[model samples]
Target: MHGKTLTFLLLLISIACLDLLLTHCGRSDHKQKLQKQDTVLLTKHWESPIPHQEIPEGLTSISAASCGTCHAEIYKEWQQSTHAVAFQDPQFQAELKKDNIITCLNCHTPLQNQQEFIVRGFINGDYKTPWKEVNPHFDKSLQLESITCATCHVRDGQVIGALGSDRAPHKTLKDPGFLSEKLCLGCHNVVDEASPQLVCTFETGDEWNANWAKREGKNCISCHMPSTERPLFPGMSKRAGHFHHFPASGIPKFKDREAGRLESMEFTESPVHPGYSPGDLLNYQLKIKNSFAGHNVPTGDPERFFLIRYQWMDASGNILKEEVHRIGEEWQWHPVAKKISDNNLKPKEERVYPFTQLLDRAGTYRFRVEVTKHRMTEENARYNQILGEYPLSIEVYSKQYEIAVE
Candidate 1:
């Protein structure tokens, strides 16, 4: 009798858990689930806005300025960061809609308070497809804050960070995940083997040379958010924290002079050849390297590209012959994104671009070579209505030579 009772109790407990899971699955909002197999649903990820929850205690509001009350320096750095204006960026705003979907907001405005809707859960346990609903708890002010302190460091009303501090006004908890690359994975790195994703972040983290970067003891944190000894906040004792600015390709000079470096230029002319005509063939080689970046030189967004130009001209700098090469990926996104070609430099990789020119009637000729980073093409700029903004193209490297022939 006693054994039968125990067995009955265990069976009942299992049934209860199964029922709870089913009910929970049914309640998810992003991908509406139905009992009928005929029903179809849309998909999403890059994680829905963090569901509505208790804000970290002891902070006045969800505004980053509220955190700035204590973490002054970090807050100020964040103000200058691209994350601070993720949603309000003019170019991003212009490119937000396609097929009438605004799903990109998940990464841009990530906190429930910042989002217009909340994802209760995903249907059929498919996180790729979330079940979303109107969020009664939405705060428009937080939307303007974009990716903020709460988005990364707050959960269940506790402050999550790399180090726990007894001195903090609120409960401080240390999460080792903060120190690893996983922290940036959702937005930067993404689902596995899922190509042609409806929304593409352009695979910045996926392109990273993990084996090489790891051998060097570097990662997203070490490269993008190098740590320093500083007070967690102003009055606290010095400890390890990282820069919040999160700089990368957004800063043109940062990539140009540092990561994508122009290493060397080699030139040769065939002047001593027997029976050589009046034309002196000029042979040139230029080396551009993606030495410092752990990922591809231009990793994110198809709009990002490098333009290499070679020109031979009279001493007056009037162009005579010019050749141009574009280094980047091309894609066709009409039906679904399919990469056509990729010539972007990979980690620690160097590419040599060579060209030849013939000089027949040259007294003194100028040879010029240049590499420029183009953040956006003018055609796309006009289509996106950001043409009035300053040209995004920035010169990374250039060289000039005066070749004299008698």
Candidate 2:
């Protein structure tokens, strides 16, 4: 009887060792392939949620309300943020209907319990090899929370972040890495497998790395997560903390800011050129600078753009002449997805527009400049069928010159 029991125990130990060996070998092989930049294989890797065996103790419910128990202020801010409704955005929903929509959920609603598929491999890529199955552990309620706090703060069944509280309701651990730009790359960095020139997804992180990182020591946290002097928790005393209402292109005012600023607008020869009279030339230079933004003025979604409108208006505010300039990346959307041109303002770069027109009449008029931020192109807007779902454009800068037409 003792020999039979020993044999069974040895057999169990052998299986456990074999499983660990296989898992380690698989991970090593995966790393090697990624170094080769096999995009299809990489796409196969990201088509699933972050792996974890169980929900964190304090986040089992996967509700923002649960975090609100101690983080009331932070929770309110998250409610107003784009991340809170990422999975539920109507435009995104419509766009995802045509293809393998489940792949998108890995980022939009990125929690193990939020997905219905336990993807083993692609039905078609490197990540889709073995096969997929229904996830018996899926929780429908968790799926609706979208990119909730747990998406970043919960991992391996613990509450993790740049700072963690021991007095809180859950097990906490401090991970300084949570504050790094790499954390944002979990979703923000994406390159196209088909067209490498035009990364078809948000390459905000990559842009920051290439254009802004080396020049400036700031990262996404410096902008998106500004410091607040709110208590880490009640009774902890006021101190610097982070929240979710990112001052990026998420809100109307932020859109105006990140889109760039109209530094100044003046005539080339101010004072209207000495002895300027009718039949003479009227000239001026309108200046625009990407003052504060770290990346291109209108980065992120390719659809985002800026419109600069230069106008000559009569005293009655009736426009007599207008010239519009577009600043954004243009793309060939059909036949093949490719970028045609990109004239977005670069970091600290200033563009000057010189205007000259014959002064044909002697009258009082106004030379005006208006800069507006457009969220997307009209064609794409109509296709998504979300023309009026929200404010599509916001006026960023407007200046009028009370001028006398010589």
Q: lDDT, candidate 2, residue 162? A: 65
Compute the lDDT of residue 64 as modeled in candidate 2. Answer: 77
- Over 18-67, each residue of candidate 2 has an lDDT whose tens digit, in order, gives 55775777765654444244223224435668774465675555467778
What tens-digit string does per-residue lDDT give for candidate 1 at 1-406? 4674465455445534655776678753322233223122444555455666586777657679888988899998887777887887667776664322345677788876777766544434443333456678888888888888888888887888776667778866788777477767778765422224344655767776454776787787788886788887656678977888777654332222222223222233323222223576766777676767777768777668888998988879899889999888876655676678988888877777888867676387788888877877888778778775644776767777878765
After superposing all C-alphas onto the true structure, candidate 2 shows an RMSD in angstroms of 10.1
Backbone clash pairs for candidate 2 read 44-127, 121-128, 121-129, 122-127, 122-128, 122-129, 268-284
Candidate 1 Cα errors over 4 Å, as ranges? 1-47, 119-132, 191-198, 251-279
lDDT for 59 in candidate 1 is 64
Give lDDT: candidate 2, residue 324.
90
Local accuracy by lDDT, each model? 0.67, 0.67
